[model samples]
Target: MTTYHVQIKVMPLKDLLDPQGKAVLGGLHNLGLNGISDVRIGKHITLQIEAESELSAKTKAEEACKKLLANPVMEFYEIEMVQG
Candidate 1:
Protein backbone atom coordinates (compact mmCIF):
# COMPACT_ATOMS: atom_id res chain seq x y z
CA MET A 1 0.00 0.00 0.00
CA THR A 2 1.03 3.57 -0.68
CA THR A 3 0.49 6.52 1.63
CA TYR A 4 -1.59 9.22 0.03
CA HIS A 5 -2.56 12.68 1.13
CA VAL A 6 -6.18 13.72 0.90
CA GLN A 7 -7.80 17.08 1.53
CA ILE A 8 -11.43 17.62 2.32
CA LYS A 9 -13.23 20.92 2.37
CA VAL A 10 -16.56 21.14 4.12
CA MET A 11 -18.82 24.13 3.69
CA PRO A 12 -22.34 25.18 4.44
CA LEU A 13 -24.83 24.75 1.61
CA LYS A 14 -25.14 27.84 -0.55
CA ASP A 15 -28.87 27.96 0.00
CA LEU A 16 -28.56 27.93 3.74
CA LEU A 17 -27.61 30.74 6.05
CA ASP A 18 -24.30 30.45 7.88
CA PRO A 19 -24.41 32.26 11.18
CA GLN A 20 -20.70 31.91 11.74
CA GLY A 21 -19.95 33.39 8.36
CA LYS A 22 -22.31 36.26 8.99
CA ALA A 23 -20.69 36.93 12.30
CA VAL A 24 -17.29 37.03 10.71
CA LEU A 25 -18.58 39.39 8.05
CA GLY A 26 -19.97 41.66 10.70
CA GLY A 27 -16.64 41.65 12.48
CA LEU A 28 -14.84 42.47 9.32
CA HIS A 29 -17.16 45.36 8.70
CA ASN A 30 -16.53 46.60 12.18
CA LEU A 31 -12.81 46.49 11.41
CA GLY A 32 -13.38 48.82 8.40
CA LEU A 33 -12.88 46.10 5.85
CA ASN A 34 -15.62 47.27 3.52
CA GLY A 35 -14.45 45.99 0.20
CA ILE A 36 -15.28 42.41 1.08
CA SER A 37 -18.98 41.81 0.71
CA ASP A 38 -19.20 38.25 1.93
CA VAL A 39 -17.41 35.70 4.04
CA ARG A 40 -18.00 31.98 4.46
CA ILE A 41 -16.45 29.77 7.09
CA GLY A 42 -15.68 26.14 6.44
CA LYS A 43 -13.54 23.20 7.51
CA HIS A 44 -10.35 21.90 5.99
CA ILE A 45 -9.43 18.31 6.74
CA THR A 46 -6.24 16.53 5.80
CA LEU A 47 -5.86 12.82 5.98
CA GLN A 48 -2.97 10.45 5.36
CA ILE A 49 -4.47 7.30 3.93
CA GLU A 50 -2.84 4.03 3.01
CA ALA A 51 -4.27 2.60 -0.20
CA GLU A 52 -3.31 0.77 -3.34
CA SER A 53 -3.78 3.80 -5.58
CA GLU A 54 -4.65 7.47 -5.67
CA LEU A 55 -8.21 6.68 -6.72
CA SER A 56 -8.60 4.36 -3.76
CA ALA A 57 -7.33 6.99 -1.37
CA LYS A 58 -9.71 9.54 -2.78
CA THR A 59 -12.61 7.13 -2.52
CA LYS A 60 -11.83 6.47 1.11
CA ALA A 61 -11.59 10.15 1.87
CA GLU A 62 -14.92 10.77 0.17
CA GLU A 63 -16.55 8.02 2.16
CA ALA A 64 -15.16 9.48 5.37
CA CYS A 65 -16.65 12.84 4.51
CA LYS A 66 -20.02 11.37 3.63
CA LYS A 67 -20.23 9.19 6.67
CA LEU A 68 -18.86 11.44 9.40
CA LEU A 69 -16.88 14.49 8.39
CA ALA A 70 -19.76 16.42 6.89
CA ASN A 71 -23.41 16.86 7.65
CA PRO A 72 -25.34 16.10 4.49
CA VAL A 73 -28.39 18.03 5.56
CA MET A 74 -26.53 21.31 6.02
CA GLU A 75 -23.09 20.96 4.49
CA PHE A 76 -21.40 19.91 1.27
CA TYR A 77 -17.89 18.62 0.85
CA GLU A 78 -15.21 18.53 -1.80
CA ILE A 79 -12.37 16.03 -1.79
CA GLU A 80 -9.01 16.17 -3.45
CA MET A 81 -5.99 13.92 -3.59
CA VAL A 82 -2.86 15.91 -2.98
CA GLN A 83 0.60 15.02 -4.08
CA GLY A 84 3.17 15.31 -1.37
Candidate 2:
Protein backbone atom coordinates (compact mmCIF):
# COMPACT_ATOMS: atom_id res chain seq x y z
CA MET A 1 0.00 0.00 0.00
CA THR A 2 1.04 3.54 -0.69
CA THR A 3 0.40 6.59 1.42
CA TYR A 4 -1.32 9.48 -0.31
CA HIS A 5 -1.92 13.04 0.76
CA VAL A 6 -5.36 14.48 0.18
CA GLN A 7 -6.79 17.95 0.50
CA ILE A 8 -10.51 18.30 0.86
CA LYS A 9 -12.16 21.66 0.56
CA VAL A 10 -15.69 22.06 1.80
CA MET A 11 -17.71 25.13 0.90
CA PRO A 12 -21.25 26.34 1.19
CA LEU A 13 -23.50 25.75 -1.78
CA LYS A 14 -23.77 28.67 -4.19
CA ASP A 15 -27.43 29.32 -3.45
CA LEU A 16 -27.05 28.95 0.28
CA LEU A 17 -26.53 31.79 2.70
CA ASP A 18 -23.19 31.76 4.51
CA PRO A 19 -23.37 34.01 7.52
CA GLN A 20 -19.67 33.75 8.27
CA GLY A 21 -18.78 34.59 4.71
CA LYS A 22 -21.17 37.50 4.73
CA ALA A 23 -19.60 38.76 7.93
CA VAL A 24 -16.15 38.55 6.38
CA LEU A 25 -17.29 40.42 3.29
CA GLY A 26 -18.71 43.12 5.48
CA GLY A 27 -15.49 43.27 7.40
CA LEU A 28 -13.52 43.62 4.21
CA HIS A 29 -15.74 46.48 3.11
CA ASN A 30 -15.23 48.15 6.44
CA LEU A 31 -11.50 47.84 5.89
CA GLY A 32 -11.87 49.91 2.67
CA LEU A 33 -11.65 46.95 0.36
CA ASN A 34 -14.84 47.69 -1.53
CA GLY A 35 -13.44 46.24 -4.73
CA ILE A 36 -14.10 42.78 -3.35
CA SER A 37 -17.83 42.27 -3.29
CA ASP A 38 -18.19 38.75 -2.07
CA VAL A 39 -16.35 36.35 0.20
CA ARG A 40 -17.08 32.72 0.77
CA ILE A 41 -15.56 31.05 3.83
CA GLY A 42 -14.75 27.41 3.67
CA LYS A 43 -12.78 24.62 5.31
CA HIS A 44 -9.55 23.03 4.18
CA ILE A 45 -8.73 19.54 5.39
CA THR A 46 -5.57 17.55 4.81
CA LEU A 47 -5.38 13.87 5.43
CA GLN A 48 -3.33 10.80 4.61
CA ILE A 49 -4.65 7.53 3.26
CA GLU A 50 -3.10 4.18 2.50
CA ALA A 51 -4.29 2.29 -0.56
CA GLU A 52 -3.19 -0.01 -3.30
CA SER A 53 -3.17 2.60 -6.06
CA GLU A 54 -3.66 6.30 -6.69
CA LEU A 55 -7.18 5.71 -7.96
CA SER A 56 -8.16 3.82 -4.83
CA ALA A 57 -6.74 6.50 -2.58
CA LYS A 58 -8.65 9.14 -4.50
CA THR A 59 -11.84 7.12 -4.38
CA LYS A 60 -11.53 6.70 -0.63
CA ALA A 61 -10.95 10.39 -0.20
CA GLU A 62 -14.03 11.16 -2.26
CA GLU A 63 -16.08 8.74 -0.24
CA ALA A 64 -14.88 10.35 2.97
CA CYS A 65 -15.95 13.75 1.70
CA LYS A 66 -19.39 12.62 0.64
CA LYS A 67 -20.04 10.68 3.80
CA LEU A 68 -18.51 12.78 6.56
CA LEU A 69 -16.33 15.68 5.51
CA ALA A 70 -19.08 17.64 3.81
CA ASN A 71 -22.79 18.25 4.23
CA PRO A 72 -24.43 17.19 1.00
CA VAL A 73 -27.48 19.36 1.55
CA MET A 74 -25.67 22.63 2.12
CA GLU A 75 -22.06 22.18 1.06
CA PHE A 76 -19.97 20.97 -1.87
CA TYR A 77 -16.47 19.53 -1.81
CA GLU A 78 -13.39 19.34 -4.01
CA ILE A 79 -10.58 16.87 -3.57
CA GLU A 80 -6.90 17.02 -4.52
CA MET A 81 -4.59 14.05 -4.11
CA VAL A 82 -0.82 13.77 -4.06
CA GLN A 83 1.80 11.12 -3.42
CA GLY A 84 3.33 11.05 0.00
Candidate 3:
Protein backbone atom coordinates (compact mmCIF):
# COMPACT_ATOMS: atom_id res chain seq x y z
CA MET A 1 0.00 0.00 0.00
CA THR A 2 1.10 3.55 -0.66
CA THR A 3 0.36 6.62 1.40
CA TYR A 4 -1.84 9.20 -0.24
CA HIS A 5 -2.92 12.72 0.63
CA VAL A 6 -6.59 13.51 0.21
CA GLN A 7 -8.29 16.88 0.13
CA ILE A 8 -12.03 17.29 0.18
CA LYS A 9 -13.82 20.57 -0.28
CA VAL A 10 -17.51 20.59 0.53
CA MET A 11 -19.66 23.46 -0.65
CA PRO A 12 -23.32 24.25 -0.39
CA LEU A 13 -25.52 23.88 -3.44
CA LYS A 14 -26.49 27.06 -5.21
CA ASP A 15 -30.00 26.91 -3.79
CA LEU A 16 -28.96 26.13 -0.23
CA LEU A 17 -28.87 28.87 2.39
CA ASP A 18 -25.47 29.72 3.88
CA PRO A 19 -26.02 31.85 6.95
CA GLN A 20 -22.39 31.78 8.02
CA GLY A 21 -21.20 32.85 4.60
CA LYS A 22 -23.79 35.60 4.44
CA ALA A 23 -22.71 36.89 7.82
CA VAL A 24 -19.10 36.94 6.78
CA LEU A 25 -19.97 38.80 3.61
CA GLY A 26 -21.84 41.40 5.60
CA GLY A 27 -18.89 41.84 7.91
CA LEU A 28 -16.57 42.34 4.96
CA HIS A 29 -18.61 45.37 3.95
CA ASN A 30 -18.41 46.73 7.49
CA LEU A 31 -14.65 46.31 7.39
CA GLY A 32 -14.63 48.39 4.17
CA LEU A 33 -13.74 45.43 1.98
CA ASN A 34 -16.07 45.91 -0.90
CA GLY A 35 -16.15 44.26 -4.31
CA ILE A 36 -16.41 40.90 -2.58
CA SER A 37 -19.81 39.63 -3.41
CA ASP A 38 -21.61 36.29 -3.15
CA VAL A 39 -19.85 34.76 -0.23
CA ARG A 40 -20.46 31.09 0.56
CA ILE A 41 -18.85 28.93 3.19
CA GLY A 42 -18.21 25.18 3.16
CA LYS A 43 -15.82 22.63 4.60
CA HIS A 44 -12.21 21.81 3.82
CA ILE A 45 -10.89 18.43 4.87
CA THR A 46 -7.45 16.94 4.42
CA LEU A 47 -6.38 13.45 5.35
CA GLN A 48 -3.94 10.68 4.64
CA ILE A 49 -4.96 7.26 3.40
CA GLU A 50 -3.40 4.04 2.32
CA ALA A 51 -4.19 2.72 -1.15
CA GLU A 52 -2.66 0.61 -3.86
CA SER A 53 -2.46 3.27 -6.56
CA GLU A 54 -3.59 6.75 -7.58
CA LEU A 55 -6.90 5.46 -8.88
CA SER A 56 -7.58 3.55 -5.68
CA ALA A 57 -6.71 6.55 -3.56
CA LYS A 58 -9.05 8.77 -5.56
CA THR A 59 -11.88 6.26 -5.38
CA LYS A 60 -11.50 5.93 -1.64
CA ALA A 61 -11.40 9.68 -1.20
CA GLU A 62 -14.54 10.08 -3.24
CA GLU A 63 -16.32 7.44 -1.21
CA ALA A 64 -15.28 9.13 2.00
CA CYS A 65 -16.56 12.45 0.77
CA LYS A 66 -19.91 11.02 -0.24
CA LYS A 67 -20.40 8.99 2.89
CA LEU A 68 -19.33 11.45 5.58
CA LEU A 69 -17.61 14.56 4.33
CA ALA A 70 -20.48 16.03 2.38
CA ASN A 71 -24.26 16.12 2.43
CA PRO A 72 -25.66 15.06 -0.91
CA VAL A 73 -28.98 16.79 -0.37
CA MET A 74 -27.55 20.24 0.14
CA GLU A 75 -23.83 20.10 -0.43
CA PHE A 76 -21.36 18.96 -3.08
CA TYR A 77 -17.70 18.10 -2.80
CA GLU A 78 -14.51 18.05 -4.82
CA ILE A 79 -11.90 15.45 -4.06
CA GLU A 80 -8.19 15.46 -4.80
CA MET A 81 -5.68 12.77 -4.05
CA VAL A 82 -1.92 12.97 -4.29
CA GLN A 83 0.85 10.56 -3.58
CA GLY A 84 2.36 11.09 -0.17
lDDT of each: 0.91, 0.91, 0.89
List the candidates' TM-scores in order.
0.95, 0.91, 0.92
lDDT of 1: 0.91
Q: Rate residue 44 of model 3 by lDDT.
A: 90
| lDDT by residue (tens digit), candidate 3, 28-83 | 99999999999999999999988888898888888888788888999999888755
Report the candidate with higher lDDT, 2 versus 3: 2
Q: Residue 41 CA error for candidate 1 (Å)?
A: 0.7
Give the poorly placed runs of model 3, Cα more than 4 Å off. none
Clashes of each: 0, 0, 0
Encode model 2's per-residue lDDT on 1-84: one tens digit a residue: 889999889999999999999999999988898788668998999999999999999999989998899999999999998656
RMSD, one per candidate, in order: 0.8, 1.1, 1.1
